[model samples]
Target: MPEITVVKVERVAGEQGQAGRVVHIERPEEWAACPECGVISTSVRQRRTTRPRDLPYGEEALHVRWHKRQFACKEALCSRKAFTESVAEIPPRARVTGRLCRAAARRVASGASVAAACREYRLGWPLTHRHFTALADAVLAEPEPVEVLGIDETRRGRARWRKNADGSWDKLERFETNFVDLSGTGGLLGQAAGRTGSAVEGWLDARGQAWKSAVQVVAIDPATCYRTAIRRALPHATIVVDHFHLIALANKAVTAVRQRVTRDQRGRRGRSVDPEWANRRRLLRARENLSQRAFTTMWNALIDHEPTGQILTAWIAKEDLRSLLACARQQQPRSVISHRLFRFFSWCAGSDIPELISLAETIEQWWPETLAFITTGITNARTEGTNRLIKDAARVAFGFRNLANQRRRVRLACTHQTINPAA
Candidate 1:
C-alpha cells in the first residue's frame, strides 16, 4: 500500500471477502498541490472516493480502494479550481495502475495470448494489446547493420483471389520477404511487403546507404528476382546461393526423371508395386544416412526396374551435388570440388535425360553463386529457421489479417530477450 506513496493501509479485516483483501487504504496528513495554479489550499473540499485497479498478487484479484486528496486552488487568477492528486504511477482518469498495465502487457509480450492475459489480469483485450504495443515500441530498436544478411520470403497468409475480367481468379500478394541477421543473432532483422525486386530494393533503400554498405554478404535461395534485387540494392555484397535450395532443386529433378522414366517404360504412372515408386523416398536420402542393407536393396531395385538407367543416373547426379555442397564442412578433400563438379556435369551430360540436362544447366547458371557458397560458406538456413518461427506465430494467432500488427508482434518476439519485455 505504501508503494502508492500517497496511500497507506489504515486497517485489515480478519475475514476474507470475495474480492480478497478489505484493508482500509488512506494517506495520513496527505498534501496535494493544485494542478491549475500550483497553489496549496488549506481549505478542505468534499472528499472524492474511487477504486483503482491493481496487479493480481494472489490466486484472487485484490480490491484496492485508493484514498487520496483533492485540492481546491487558492489562487484567484487560476482557471482550474480543484484537482485530484495524481502520480506517474497512476495517471488521472486511469482505471488501472501503470505497473498493472505493464504486467499484463508483459504477459502477452512473453508469448501468452491476449485472451490468456485478459483472463489472468482481468483486463480487456484492447487495453492489453495497446500496452503491449507501447512496451514493444519503447524497447525494440531499428535493426543494426549485419555482416551476413539472409533473405527469404514467407507466405503472409492464405492467398486471396479476385475474379478477373476473363472470369479467372488470380492470387493477391501472398508473401513477405524476411531479412535476417545470420551472423549476429540469427534473429529476423526486418520484412517488406512483397517478394519482388522492388520490395527488396525498397526495404534496402530504407535502411540507408551506410547500412547497405556494411552488409558484406547476403545468403538467399537461387531466385532471379532476389538476385536482381540484391545487385541493385547492395551491388558490393556477395550473394551466396543457399545449398539447401540447390540440393532441393537437385532432388526435384531426380523425382521428375523417375516419373518420366516410369511413364515411358511402363506406359503408366508408377504404381505402389513398382520398385521405382516404392524406393522413391530412398532416392532423396543422403548415402551416409542409409544403411548398407537398405542401400543395396534400392540399388538392386533400380538396376532391375530402371533398365534405361536414367532414373539411377539422376539419383547419382543428386548425390554428387549433395557431396559438392558437403565440401563446406571439410577442408579441400583429395576429391577436389572441381573433380566433384566435373563428375556431376559428366553424369548429367552422358545421361541424355532432359530433366538431368535441365538441372545441369540451372546448376551451371548458378555456378558463380554456388562458388560463393563454397568460399564464404554462408547459407539461408538461419533465415529458413526464422521463417518457421514467423509461421508458428501466425499459426498460433490463427493468421493475422493486419500485416502491421503481424509484423509488430513477430518483430517484438524475435528481437527482445525472452525475459525482458519492458524497458
Candidate 2:
C-alpha cells in the first residue's frame, strides 16, 4: 500500500471573499510519468515547475505543484519530442474540480438561474451559463417523441406595454398557450399560436414527420387553423374538438337565439310571447346560480313553448349538446362522432337559428377534421398545466430580459432530469 502524505493547502486571494486558496501537491517517484518522453522516468533531470488544479474539498482549493522534466524517446528515427503529462486526479484544461462541475450542472438543471447558480457556487456567471447551456444542449439533442397532441393558444405580450422617456422599455408580459401530447404527458409543445392549426403545424414541423405520424389524434378547439395544420402535417391523425369548448359553443348559440327572439318581439305589433319564456332564458343564462327546482321550471316552461322562435333554437342547441355528450359517452372513434356532428350541422341549416348557419358553414369548411373526434379523445390538459408551470418560472425570474434565455429557461423548467449529480 502507498503511504499517504500531507501536501500544503493555502487560501486563494481574489476580487471577492467568496473564493478559497490553492493547495500545492507533493508526489512520490511512482506518482508521475515523464512529460517529455513516453517512459515513466524515475531518474531526475533538470526540472521546470508548473501549477495545476486538483479535486476540491469544501472550502479548500486544491492544486498540483508540478515538476516537469524532459524525457528521451530512445529510438534514433523516432523523431521523439518532449511532452508534458497531467495528473490523474484532475482534467488538463479545467480549473475547478469534477465534483464542483457536477454540482453546478445539477443546480442549473434544477431550474436555478445562471447568475444565482454562479453566486451560490462562488464561480463566474459566464462559467455557469456555459455549463448550463451544455447541459440543455445534451438534454434537447435527444427527446422522446410524442403522439396524441392537445392544441391550444395563449396570449404573448399584452397590448399595453410602452417605453419611458429613456431608451429602456418596460418588460414584455405574456400569457401561455399550451399544447400537450396526452400519451406521454410531456410538457407543452407548440408556443406559436397556442391551440390553433398554425401552432400545431409549427410544433409538428419541429417534431418531424416520424413523430407526427405517431400522433393518432389531436384534440383542439374549433379553430380552423388547427384543422388546416393537422391536414397539412399529420394527414392521417384524428382530430377531436374538445368537449368543453363544444359545450361552450352550444351555450353561445343558445344565447344568440335568445337575443334574436327578444329582437323579434320588439319588431312585432306589441304582442309578445309569454314572459315566462324570457324568464327561462334568464334562468338558462344564470344556470350555474339556479336551484334544481328553478332549472326544472325553466325546462318545463321551454317545453310549453311548443317549439318556435328563440325557444326552438335554444332547444336545437340543447339537443345538439345532448347528442355530442351521448356520442362522447359512447367512446366511438372521434371520426364517427365527427361525422354525426357534420350531419347535425347540415340539419341545423334548416332551422330558424341564424347562428347555426354560420356555425355550419365554418364546420363544413373544416368538416373533414371536425369529424375526426370520434377516434381520438385527446385534449390540451397537459399543455395547459405545463404552461402554468412555465409562467410561474417566468414570474420567479422577474421575466427574462432576453427571449433566448427565456426559451432556455422554459426548456429547463419543463424537462425532467435524467442525469444524476450524485453519479
Best by TM-score: 1
**Per-residue alpha-carbon lDDT of candidate 2 for residues 1-423, written as tens digits (9 for 90 to 100):** 122234675666645556666545444444344443445444443465565433345654444465444444443444544434344444444566555655776687786766677777677777767777777677654346766777666554443467889877775445444556577735544355334556556767887778777877777777776678778998787777765565566666766766666557555332245653456445345344668887677667666753565555655555664465456458866676766675576667777467877656655565554445533445555666666767777776666666666666676677554766674
List candidate 2 stretches off by more than 4 Å. Answer: 1-30, 33-95, 142-146, 154-180, 185-212, 250-323, 330-371, 401-404
Please give the TM-score that candidate 1 achieves against the real structure: 0.90
Model 1 C-alpha lDDT per residue in residues 1-423, reported as the tens digit of each score: 444544444334434544355334555545677776788776667576678788766654457776767777788999988887777667788888888889988887777777788998889989998998898777677888989998999998877998999999987998999999988863788899898999999999999999999999999999999999999999899999999888899899989988988898899999999999999999999989999999999999999877788878888999999988878877565469899899999989988889889999999999989988987788888888888878877876778877888998787766635545443
Instruction: List per-prediction Cα lDDT, in the order shown.
Output: 0.83, 0.60
Report lDDT (Cα) of residue 60, candidate 1. Answer: 47
Worst 10 residues of 2 by lDDT: 268-277
TM for every model, in the order presented, reads 0.90, 0.58
Candidate 2 whole-model C-alpha lDDT, 0 to 1: 0.60
Which numbered prediction scores highest in lDDT against the true structure? 1
